[model samples]
Target: MEMNLVIVGLVFVVLGYLVGVKKFTWLLAGYNEKRVKDKNKLALLVGGTFALLGIGIAISGFAGIQQAETIMFVAIGIILLELVYVNVKMVE
Candidate 1:
């Protein structure tokens, strides 16, 4: 299956924006809305950073920049960490 990195990057960008704005909380099953809604600097920071990285990756993909795949992977890893961070912060 051939997947376009640009599309993947866009998905991340949208997700980042949603997460940053706290609009993606509903996607988390069984997670308390109040906890998720609480102000979390770390979560916001990670989401903003994810958005920037996604945009950079998308630009790199279109520009044929070398190591774009690596950036994408890094972004993916950060997002996974971001999820854990969000969960942890919410419970605290």
Candidate 2:
């Protein structure tokens, strides 16, 4: 099993929960509270993305997938898309 990936994935999942469900927006990187147009929307979008990404990583790790690098690249792509979307639509 890919222990490293599993550990990282769990970290992401915890972060997601803290930011999304617990409303700990301060944990988010490069976040400016005053700049976000809607805090709830931002949390939901980013948190959901992180959580899903974590789940994917965890599953890949557990399955010992040979294409782990590919999965990571895909996850990075998704995160980039999320960043663009947040910057364009959520920021003030």
Candidate 3:
């Protein structure tokens, strides 16, 4: 169980990175003429959140708590969806 949680946690983190990088690249390329304050903030917020999430999952794996790991999954999912929304807004 612990090993599985660790692995699943890592996957969530990678997925988060994938989504974030995609959005960041698009933001940078599409808004080259703009100030890019929001883009920079988004990068920092999303990147830091994922880093913390990955570390939390790793720690939870050591502690062996299923609930904590599940919460992490939910958090990751929510973050993913939020990123998608942000990307859509950027297009408008």
List the candidate 2 regions with Cα displacement exceeding 4 Å: none
lDDT, each prediction: 0.67, 0.87, 0.61
Per-residue alpha-carbon lDDT of candidate 3 for residues 36-87, written as tens digits (9 for 90 to 100):
3476556655655665677677668768876864666677696678567656
Per-candidate RMSD, Å:
3.9, 1.1, 5.7
lDDT of 3 at 3: 79
Displacement of residue 82 (Cα, Å) in model 3 is 4.4
lDDT of 2 by residue, 1-92 (tens): 88877887888788889888888999988999999999998998888888988998988888887677788899889989999999999998
**Weakest ten-residue segment in model 2 by summed lDDT:** 63-72
Ranking by TM-score: 2, 1, 3
Model 1 ranges off by over 4 Å: 1-3, 28-30, 34-43, 66-69
For 1-92, candidate 1 gives per-residue lDDT tens digits of 11366776687688778767775645444556565546455446656876787787777778766675677678768768867877776655
Worst 10 residues of 3 by lDDT: 24-33
**Worst lDDT window (10 residues) for model 1?**
25-34
Residue 62's lDDT within candidate 1 is 81
TM-score: the better of candidates 1 and 2 = 2
Query: Candidates' TM-scores?
Result: 0.61, 0.92, 0.51
